[model samples]
Target chain A: MRGGTAVSIAYQTLRLSDLPGLRAAIRSGDYVKHTAGLGAGHLQTNLAILPEAYALDFMRYCQRNPKPCPLVGVSDTGDPMMRTLGRDIDIRTDVPAYNIYLDGKLADSVTDITDIWRDDMVAFALGCSFTFERALEEAGVPQWHIDHDTTVPMFRSNIETVPAGPFGGKMVVSMRMIAPERIDEVREISRRFPLAHGAPVHIGDPEGLGIADLSRPDWGDPAEIEPGKTPVFWACGVTPQVAIERAGVPLCITHKPGHMLVTDISETAEVPVLNPKHH
Target chain B: MRGGTAVSIAYQTLRLSDLPGLRAAIRSGDYVKHTAGLGAGHLQTNLAILPEAYALDFMRYCQRNPKPCPLVGVSDTGDPMMRTLGRDIDIRTDVPAYNIYLDGKLADSVTDITDIWRDDMVAFALGCSFTFERALEEAGVPQWHIDHDTTVPMFRSNIETVPAGPFGGKMVVSMRMIAPERIDEVREISRRFPLAHGAPVHIGDPEGLGIADLSRPDWGDPAEIEPGKTPVFWACGVTPQVAIERAGVPLCITHKPGHMLVTDISETAEVPVLNPKHH
Candidate 1:
């Protein structure tokens, strides 16, 4: 992990919060990189665009699985403007990368999706760990993957998500290594952002989560546990993708893993993860 | 406010925690009264059953207007059972009475909806003031109308709810006369049940809420202020009814104004009213 990469990502995050300016870069194809460490104080979301036919069921699925799918904003059918998420935000161009799906299979990875935007499409934005990951960085906790310019270590967990309509799958989790002394501080900061997956689902012992090895991850890089540090896991946004693929809708699109939409909503915004029955 | 009504209502509430016994009484033709004080500690929800076509937009409407529409449970399309709300809960016969709407007009009022149930209908449960009003009672605060056996005074306010598709209308508020000394305690208690309209939207003024006189309310009975009491208002669940009526779908069904469904969920349950942007 390099010290300079963290500083560079930090600079982009701080500067881009002048959101319009940052979005211009992404919109104009001047900045095409993954939005891993960008967009600091504002909420960053995992995007999913589904047909109107599948929208209602998917919403129920999200409500049932708030830990992995903390919904931040939903767009009206056929509407490209995510007005609730940000001022003058166009869902088709705001996100840097998109995974286009045809009949539930990934067909293409593109920078801009305006060409394929349809009249019956509905876009939904779910909260990503990017918000809380920045919180950890601000609170003096180290992020191994961000510094290394690598993806966070994510794993497929044994826990099953509550099924809705045609969506159901096992949960996916992201792991971070935290020193024992800083564990309390990390938990305190993270739990406050319920939209950002809240507290750790598992603090230590990967085997308990049914992961056979820390070295082998289902997705992303393997984050090694430093001496005296425990492995902490948070529900990952990828869990929804798994359900979507299994549901196999004819046309579905999502942010290519690691790329996210930077929402105008701030981290301090007080939306709690809703009770399942209350959702 | 009377002495014996409060005592009798309290007695039914306590005896009903034996839920099966309570529901059996409601399920059969035996108990057909309003559910106001009957389910003290459990979650009591305002019910709305909509055709599948209108379900998505109505959901967005609820998500957009959390103070007035704190969504508690959503039934799967065409499903009569609200699996998430309570065990063995059948929507058709559970609520004491239902308002049947055809083309936005009240067509009929009935105790059970099974005879009219269809394959493309969805039922949604929104948190009602019944839960928080019970809290006010438990906290030693006085509810003028409840104690007097009258409907809580509700008024239409000038605040416009964020509109979704065909659902957009002004918010409705419920007013209560609170002794100035207990105002803080009432606010503190109500805010904790975000699912229960959170805190008061206005305190100590009727004119400011655009009411010409507190003596006349738009819905429910008028609550008069006692010598040292102040008028406190919370956003009412009826706000959604206004939107639903304006949308005027071909078929819409809701619980009768004062009648509600007593859910298996408890009042102490921790569902927060979501941030509008984050919903």
Candidate 2:
């Protein structure tokens, strides 16, 4: 299984443009691994599934804190199909892995959730930072964490998200070290992808976000701040997980940390500008 | 009363920056008039109130159809205080007038909704075109409707808004005639206010939107399309009103056509960018 996972990861990296094929591999359980660089030009989303009772308040929380939770697609109540996101994506089995939470505590991880599917479940697909990370890589901006083949370091920041019902907690952010010269270019490029956590929440001074040490992080790997490099922070998708823990709902489901749901929508697809003439 | 209303309208035109004083006048029934140019640099919003049972669906509708319904602020259930919009905005009495809709039919127009405020009701304040209109006026583009002291002509368009649940209908657009050369500048200026209906949905042909005659509009008085001036259309705030009517909810409340809720936020107030460094 380990060798099979490694081979599948290599294959996925080579066929970055084949979204449907990649999704198929993920759905079939043949490629059960992180989807960091799988769908290069396509949008990858963080998943959150909650019962209909908690759906409204959670939606409000996303609305209030859009930077951390840019919602790309939402499924109808009790519906497993995400029609707006892809041609035939099933929420229950599309992702490589899903983390099942019982009363906000991790109960188990599973490849398929069909057994736990409920009549009142609502799935939310949120934009992930990988979309903008690809954009940055395309524009020649180097990412230290990616180069080192390690997960991006994430930290819980001092900044508090606007409270909506039980979904309120300090925001979580991911750090990337970049040369000072490329900071402006990176900011400009990222701002275009507002749906994917556009722009840096902080460019320098980790202490500003209440982080005492650059070497210590709440999640993922520790990044080295090389000479002439500055630390840049962006709102992380893990934020919803933090909120979910605080909410302590009876049952909640989410994609594993780095494992994501790949959608058919292009990362560069201009946020739908409704032009009557074109229609 | 007619003379007093006229005097208050003129008074409001002069005291554009005084939002609180203006709201006081509106609350007192001293200014029962259109709020086109009332709050010059401040943001004016279109109001919609719905029962909690229908709130989630209505919010989903707005999320799916953001062009016509860019939500600026949402109130907690049964809470009339719009804390985010202004210092002391009471949803019940801040607007100059309210339109009561009972089962999709116009029941009556009232000056205050204090008597009808429900514990299960939720209020939503949506971005109005007035914010971008002020930007256009500031940028030296003449709005013929405002110049003539008349309402902007609104029409029902062929463009169907992306629906959610029971809320589904064709979009409503407000038309403004612009000189051919200034069309580019107007588009650029208006694009800055994405929250305020963003850019024109149609630039030249009224027939494209299914409007056969410019002189006959579904709502508001007609404006003459001056020679060499092309007709430009923008998504109107009234699109939600049409959806509310189509949904046929038992009871709904909205600001009477041109009567809006004046908020204290500046028109140019940069959309809150979550920067941890700044905090």
Candidate 3:
């Protein structure tokens, strides 16, 4: 039980009580690793930390293009604690890994962003496909990537996102191979989770979204498309990261691909990231 | 045209092409009046401006209590131009009127905020009930407001809004008298405009939402519950103003009641205020 088997046991038996300790361990120098299946049933999010100057436009970008960037939590300017997401979650160090970008370029990767944290910085937590992936598995929808032990294939599309100030770029989509019979099930299940890239954007023909070949993806490993199966594409969270890169902002930070911040919010509940009910 | 009645004609016959001129007229001090039917069929929005320090919380406040504050536009911090709603519209002067609040108290009313504008201020445009009121009229649901030419009846409800940061207060509701047969028709019509305080929150029984009597209201005019008519209550845009008053923020600004910023967006065809199709 050294590799995949160990991961299975660690994830299958994971409980809510074990999350705090696990997150604390990650925050320290102990468990710096990918958070793929660590806390099942809890929501995991893609992180983007940017200067206050870019916050409003980025928010507008999200508001205008919610499918790719369904905002889940927004931290106060200069504040790191995402009080709405979890208790005592220090964004600067809680994530398993951080990807540092300088002038819209990937400059370095690190386990913590404590030294880089600034008072003018604001953080955004966006819903990731992981939430819906979990749902797909529960609903008995077969995913070729998980079956073949590869990452979900993603492609850059020609679809231009509604521009907001300096943030504008083509939408990026992730592809999954599903059987013909299970397509409706996937659609039904995904629509219920709007926070998670809800529903498939396209059902078939990779060329429809400008994908030349499913085997050659711009990002992530390509999965097999079995006979009688159709490829489903969903709006990917990476679209913003790409836009951020193209904008050439002076400084930005995001969660490293596959390394996410697991939140205490239950994946099954319709929890509001902003909690506007009492206002 | 002596009072609002005489002025109503100037707006009722006004065409969409005149919006830019109307906004310009307001900006140049030539017009200091309420914006009602000036841009007929176009959307009019309630405005709220806050400093960056309180923006994230207030954004959450609006997100949580969307019915009252169905966010139509949010300006980037320090930028007064509302890029999404209108290209030429400037937040500083486009609105016909503004009420300034200091420490939760009314400070002054102004026609333009240009003199007091700050680089860190953020502007928010919330959907006004005017759009849905128009829809109800089109659906043949007679509104006491349009018939009597009075402000719709508004009440402070027993329902407490979900609190976010320092913003939390009782929910406010606007009531309209609808014929019994038109209740569902009104609901169907209003439901189409989520940004316009979508549908009725309460259909009847004023006591259910903590109202003592129909004749008395926390804000706006009293109502006459005509025979075979039921009082339909919708979430009022006044909720945020109530919350702002309770929060006691150092400063806040809201559209003077009934005055709004009319936009190029049409009342019927504009995408759902928070619709994913456009976002």
The best candidate in terms of DockQ:
2
Chain A TM-score, each candidate: 0.90, 0.93, 0.92
Compose the digit string of candidate 2's lDDT tens values, residues B146-241: 787778899999988877899989999999999999999998888777679887888898888899999888998899888889999999999999
Give the per-residue lDDT of model 2 (tens digit) for A1-279: 112356555665544347877787788776677888777577889999999999888987887677789877788888998766777889999998999999999999998999999999999999999889988988888887887778899999998887778898999999999899999999888877778887788889999899999899999999887878999999889999999988999999999988899887788764432223332
User: Distance (Å) between predicted and true CA of B252, model 3?
Assistant: 5.4
lDDT tens digits by residue: candidate 1, A1-279: 233465466445434436776788778766666776556567789999999999999988877667788777888899999867777789999887899888779999998999999999999999899888888988879988877777889999887777888898888999999988888899878876666777777789888889999888899987766788899889899999989999998989999987788877776654421211111
Residues B133-163, candidate 1: write the lDDT tens digits.
Answer: 8778878887889777888889988777778
Location of the lowest summed lDDT over 10 successive residues in candidate 1 chain A: A270-279
Deviation from native of the Cα of residue B1 in model 3, angstroms? 22
Checking candidate 3 for backbone clashes, the offending pairs are A64-B279, A65-B279, A276-B64, A276-B65, A277-B64, A277-B162, A278-B161, A278-B162, A278-B163, B1-B6
Q: Which stretches of candidate 2 lie over 4 Å from their true place?
A: A1-9, A12-16, A181-185, A270-279, B1-9, B12-16, B181-185, B269-279
Q: Residue A258 CA error for candidate 1 (Å)? A: 3.3
Q: Write one digit per residue (lDDT tens) for candidate 3, span B19-91.
A: 7777777777666776655665778999999998887678877765667778778887788987667767788
- Top TM-score prediction, candidate number: 2
Lowest lDDT sum, 10 consecutive residues, model 3 chain B, at B270-279
Best candidate according to lDDT: 2
Q: Model 2 Cα displacement at B46 (Å)?
A: 1.4
Between prediction 2 and prediction 3, the one with superior DockQ is 2
Q: What is the C-alpha local distance difference test score of each model?
A: 0.80, 0.83, 0.79
